[model samples]
Target: MSMWSFILLLISVQCVFGTSSDADETLSVMEDDSVTLHADVSAIKREDQILWRFGPENSRIAEIYKQNMPTYDINERFVDRLEMSIQTGSLTIKNIGIQHSGLYKVTIISNGGTSEKRFRVIVCARLPIPNITRDSSQCSSSSYCSLLCSVVNVSAVTLSWYKGNSLLSSISVSDLSISLSLPLEVEYQENNIYSCVINNPITNQTTHLNITQLCQPCADTTRCGSAEAVIRLVVSVVVGVATVAVLVDHFRSVSDTSPLVP
Candidate 1:
């Protein structure tokens, strides 16, 4: 056989007897949440054995074997917070933390043969609803207004500004903190609306700003506040004049009824 034909046959043989793993399988969970990684096995025979491994080096995490009856064992890293099913070959991790994010591999061996599947887990805390606060000191219609987007109890996140579906500005940080902020400035206009979005792999939050509400000419003249006060002053003056006229009429009536002294 030619060298090219020999290489093609070798590739087909590897495809038939490979470790049989998938890399794109993904699972996401929030910190302090519980998650289960499926083994994709339906049933297991009495002689079948299952091994679950984690990390890049494939450190053994848990296993199920049939020494006498169905037996289960887990490494010290996951001894107290893991559950493995012998029948379905599923692994459940409880109270998962951000440190638990990694690659997981499960190998199932039975009378048929050995098959393996892999999963990539991502665990992160969900950021709270982001707040949009206008910086009036830097805000004006002649130039631009500075807006601040922030959230508490979150770190290692991304904050961004979006006008409709298009991205305007974004910031990302690797360090952690209790609060994070992203500042952006846009020209003052009453026709467009902007949004502040904070996101992570697991979740996201967003808030919106209406330009009409922020512009000076539009907000200050929303039917005008001083105009309403002027109307009230005019109403009070008319009421006071009517009241004085009634009191004068009452006094004159009393004076005419009084008897004159000789």
Candidate 2:
């Protein structure tokens, strides 16, 4: 091969590998929210052709040529959910869900050569409010109050308990949508504030603990309810017996006062 031809072959190989080295942008959005992937270009040039692809298959999802109108694929997975910017060739996914979370790429073709951008998207579920409840088993302790901060059907989040802006305890879940609980024990007479928080990468929800209401001794309410029920049952039995005895005595008296006619 000629030296010039060999040099051209090496340049072609470099270009092919250079396109694969584009840095991927990591982005996170809450489920059912919209996310936009920017092209980072100030404006689309007249001679540029923009193409957007998604997932491991790199399926073509949207495209725009020159100053012409943009077009989107009719694939059911992305139907009515894809939008592209005419000014900058940015792509927007509306009402994004977990299924839509994956790799996305945009290729710009022009006289200058080909350039690419990649995005790694993650759609996290909305975080549930952390629940603060007194642990019944620990309620027997006279000095300390056992409490739990919990959240259910959550993934990629951290459940934490805080005391006056300081973290007391925390638990986290990665990929599985499951339950998480963190326990904290505080003095019954503690005047410090407490809260439970559940958070994902996108957002967080918190619940404040009412120490006076939840941390009370379990005996205060459970035993009282039991005693009241027993008292009601005993009173009802006694009234029933008294009524039966009185009725029998009245019938006997009537029989004795009746005339002794044959």
Candidate 3:
């Protein structure tokens, strides 16, 4: 072959091999909380091997599949949770938790060359129990009797108001605090049970409030008198108990001293 022809042939061969080595590999997280690793390996004609690694730098090998066989060496935390199928080169991670959130790398090796792809895994926290309370106003008829629902230490807030499991209204806010105005049209009896559901994409929490409508004439006088009587009785009992204890201690001390005379 001529020198130019030989050179051209060598370049063509390198180009073919290079193109074949660059297989399109991608990683995705499925709806079932499984991490899927897929690659188009049709270009490579040899026996290709697939390896899966996880973590920030892909320093840990979660599983290995080569020549249509499976070998797993996952971390203790992911012993039964990590699974991979070699035939389709797919990895399924079950029951993903906060600890499992990180980067996953898939490496494909064959006679042509080696290629890799990376994907990020994210896990959200369990939602907290929401706190719902009546902010102010002693009477239900008062216009300022507002209800507040607070979700502490929560992010990506989605706050919703409900009455007996039926959704009344929903609001989305960037912060955890959400204030909902009680509908004046709603009967006072119907306002007794109000529930607030706080949620994010991954977790949900709820709380409830019971606002009893106050009968001003009955509640103010009757409740105040009853509460005062109860408070006085409690104080008298506590004082009586304290006096008895003191007397008993004093008698016991005196008896101990007299016994020393023996």
TM-score ranking, high to low: 2, 1, 3
Quality of model 1 by C-alpha lDDT: 0.72
Which ranges of candidate 1 are over 4 A from the true structure? 1-26, 56-60, 67-80, 136-144, 152-156, 175-180, 186-191, 210-262
TM-score of each model, paired residue for residue: 0.58, 0.74, 0.51
Residues 111-188 of candidate 1: C-alpha lDDT, one tens digit per residue = 889999888776666578888877666643345667788887665567898988999888775444457777877776
- Residues 1-262, model 2: lDDT tens digits: 7754453343333222222333477676777999999988678889999999997789999999987899998889899999999999999999987678667999999888999989877666677788888888767636788988888876567788888899987887563547888888888767889999887655789999998888775466667889999999999999999999999999999999999999
Off by over 4 Å in 2: 1-22, 220-262
The 10 consecutive residues of candidate 1 with the worst lDDT sum are: 11-20
Consecutive 10-residue window with the lowest summed lDDT within model 2: 11-20
Screening candidate 1 with a backbone cut-off below 3 angstroms (N, C-alpha, C), the clashing residue pairs are none
Which stretches of candidate 3 lie above 4 Å from their native place?
1-46, 63-65, 128-146, 152-156, 160-187, 190-195, 202-218, 221-262
Give the best candidate by lDDT: 2
Predicted structure 1, TM vs. truth: 0.58
Screening candidate 2 with a backbone cut-off below 3 angstroms (N, C-alpha, C), the clashing residue pairs are none
What is the number of residue pairs that collide in model 1?
A: 0
